[model samples]
Target: MAELTGRIALVTGGGRGIGRSVALSLASAGADVAVTARSPKELDETAAAIRALGRRAEAIVCDVSERTQVDAMVARVKTALGDPLILVNNAGIAASAKLTDTTDEMWDRMLRVNASGAFYCTRAVLPLMLAAKWGRIVNMASVAGRAGAPYIAAYTASKHALLGLTRAVAAEVASRGITVNAVCPGYVDTEMTDASAANIVKRTGRTEEDARKILEGFSPQGRLMTAPEVAAMTTYLCSDVARGINGQGIVLDGGALQS
Candidate 1:
């Protein structure tokens, strides 16, 4: 039996990487999926993949950092797939800079996209969850959120804020049958990580392989984390078996940061 049978799930950034993996996994588990992203083309591709899995799917164009867009996206999802019982706040952006070199614009953008975006999406979906008396919210956080990284202060701070939001909202809805949690992965092999590697190469004048090695070495296992690995964790969190795991930040970093 599928764990998510009859569930409706909404995944932000569902166009690619971890978001795409999570959306497909949920559909495989029998949940109808609604996908949102800034790119309509990517959203359509993800929607098509979900439908290919024998599930209903809808694509919505949205930038989760914008409150109005978030609201409209949620409304569309509710109308198309019914109220989303599972929400994965998977949209985020990251950049690296020394604390003294981080620009005001970079700081603001990180917080706006990574933290505020999750806040807007969560706020938009909570009402429906409360009314139904059941919901699961999983924020895509990072190991940087748990531990400080020297060059990416803004990204780290935003992820930390996301974790804080997850805990606060989880507590508020604990009695309402809604669970809010976060998945913190370290150095996942995604487009974001690829960009980070390229950035490192540009900054340090190192070979791309060398820059990638730095990331892979972050995990004790000496390998980069895969999107499917993170998606699996997110998928489990949305299931009945994970009801007791609320208000937590589950780490999937190959035991990199033992907190």
Candidate 2:
């Protein structure tokens, strides 16, 4: 039997990057999936991909940073696929800037989208999971959450706050059949990384490949991590075999942080 047979999952930031990959992974594992993001077109594409995998799918246009929008999106999911058994808080944004140059708006945007967005989605889904007594919550954090990075203080701070949120909620729900965890990846090969590379090119006149290699250098493998690699870890966390794993932050940086 498929590992996730009969499960219902909701993935925010599902329009692209890691969220889209995780949504497809969950659907392929037999979970009816609901994908939410701000882009209608991208959401449709992800939903169609999920449906092609033979699982029921829905696409919701949502900005997770907004509480009302999140609440509404959850309500819609409940109506379409019943309460989601798995929630992947994948909606986030990243900005690169030195601490001294970081504007208040930049800091707020990072915290609001990357940290508070996860919190809102988790809050909206908790009731459904509690009622059912079995749930999986995966927060899409970053390596910056665990360690500081140069010139991206705002982004790093937001991820740190996300990890704190993950740990605290995991503790609160430990006794329940719910597991809350974070998946931290370093320099994933996604649109976000491409944008970062472009920014580097504009700033330093380096070739795109060189800028990309700079990011990939963070991983011991000397390559940027793939979206599917991150998705596999996420799907595992939602499976029955991972029931024992709770309140943990699993790093997928190809041994970058050997602690």
lDDT of 1 by residue, 1-259 (tens): 2399999999999999999999999999999999999998898999999999999999999988899999999999989989998999999998888899999999999999999999999999899899999999999999877989788899999999999999999999999998999999999899999999999899899999999999899999999999998888999999989899999999998987887
lDDT of 2 by residue, 60-128 (tens): 999988999999999999999989979999999988987899999999999999999999999999988
What total of clashing residue pairs does each candidate reach? 0, 0
Clashing pairs in 1: none
TM-score for each prediction?
A: 0.98, 0.98
- Against the reference, the lDDT scores of all candidates come to 0.93, 0.93
Candidate 1 worst ten-residue window by lDDT = 1-10
